[model samples]
Target: MKVFYYLKHIGLALLPHSWFTRRQRKLEQKFADQQDYIQRRVDYYLKTAQPFTLAPEETTAIADYTRRGFTSYFYDLKEYLHYFPKQCRFAYYFGDETHIEPRHTLFKARPIAGDNERSVIFKLDKRRHFRFVEDTLSFAEKKPMAVFRGAVTQPHRIRFMETLFGHPLVDAGQSNPSETHPEWQQPFMSVEDQLQYKFLFALEGNDVASNLKWAMSSNSLVFTPKMVFETWFMEGTLQAGVHYVEVKDDFSDVEEKINYYLAHPEKAQQIIDNAHAYLAPYQNPDLEDLVCIKVLERYFSLSGQLEK
Candidate 1:
């Protein structure tokens, strides 16, 4: 297993740049298809709700790529922004983060939405790859430790994992190209497998951790570093210590925090309960549909396209 893992990484490292480019193109196509499917669903819901009534002239055709094929994640901002109208009242962005200058009217969406101008609106997690767990283990039945499985995309994540390695209460690893254990060949844990643990570590990669949403749905207490990024479900709304345990950005005190939680099981349990309560609303598909409707209505209103 270890040999296979290292060999795979080595093979990729030895491959030419074009190989990765082709692989990325394939991934982009897959993401585009998923986004289109979600857009269809949103359209159906909007039509059913009849959230806004607009005349032909009042119906502003915002350049929405939600149903079109375009790279939303890890895109070239300058190149992508060129496709949007410069002086439009509002342009919707489905990318991971919004990079358009405040002078422009474009807004970011998905994962985390909103930009420096606060024009971006929040939307539910749209990636079809996420595994949504309807059932989660109780805190008492969960493993009394923390676990993280993801790619090592940023240096801070690497440092964080290194600091927590070999800790008695922490069980962490990489899913792809295993940074911490390059030689270890372990299959990526399913979302259900991860929820069995009492504590789940949420770390950033490329953008905010998408797993954070899944973790919130579970009964486990999430321990994360100070987040510089946010997703559709803003992290700011969650109170640290109550909804989750926040470690330093550098994760220097992760061990100490884990020890504290271990000694005070009741306190940790309260945090777990709070997390479950806060995320309960998102579990409903109807609620997500309503959020989609609200986002579109707000966009239309702000863009001056909604009929009086």
Candidate 2:
């Protein structure tokens, strides 16, 4: 399995852009029938399910992009929403991001699905369980520096790395087309290995970093920049000092933040504990289902669909 994974990665790296475009087109064509079926299923589920009791002002129309890349999180959300009870009052507007535009609605919790884009799907329960090196380690025992491993996709990431390249407080390196070494040459770090560190850097890539959830799950304090994007978990809902330390997007204050946290170990641990507590409600799969139901209820109430 490892060999096949590497071979595919290498092939993708060597393949031309046109090859991926053609592959994407083929994927859209192949999933067209399944997409149509899912859409119909969604309609049936919403129209026939038990009615929810909501206030008059709660009913509103929600717009979701119907035509999305097969791998998009929005596609998964569409599938999940099907399991919800039929909400006759809730109305759906199906269109792409370009047409619908993401408002401060339930849909904003999901990543924007687009053509040839890499995105993180918000599924806390479906992650790979990693075997830790040991049961526990003290804050002093773990590496004092923050660790970050990901591809250099955006210019902001590149600039951040360049500034902190040789900083003692940071053990940052690239995993995809690795900056420390060649692509697919170095062994990937397991989640357990990352948990061994005192601090974890959750930087944005093509979209939000998938590692952010795992970081929050761990005992280590998470440091991330103010995100322009959000997932179903809503990073915006988390407070900077309470849940995770917020770093400047330009990364000018990363070093300062790290130094302060290291000096005040108690404060850092408090934030880590708070983050875990904040995420506890979302740890269950049932909460996601409830969120979908509530979102629909609100949409229906706001749109005056119940009056119909």
RMSD, one per candidate, in order: 13.0, 13.8
Model 2 lDDT per residue over 149-242, tens place: 7777578788767777667887777666744535323346777787778988888765566677778877788888877555545654678899
Question: In model 2, where do residues sit more than 4 Å from their true spots?
Answer: 1-75, 83-138, 178-187, 304-308
TM-score of each: 0.66, 0.60
lDDT of 2 at 26: 62
Residues 39-141 of candidate 1: C-alpha lDDT, one tens digit per residue: 5433322223223233444222433322344342212222222222433234445555545433222333322223343334345334432335665467778
User: lDDT for every model?
Assistant: 0.58, 0.55
Of candidate 1, the 10-residue stretch with the lowest lDDT total is: 74-83
lDDT for position 233 in model 2: 56
Q: Which residue pairs show collisions in model 1?
A: 111-231, 111-232, 112-231
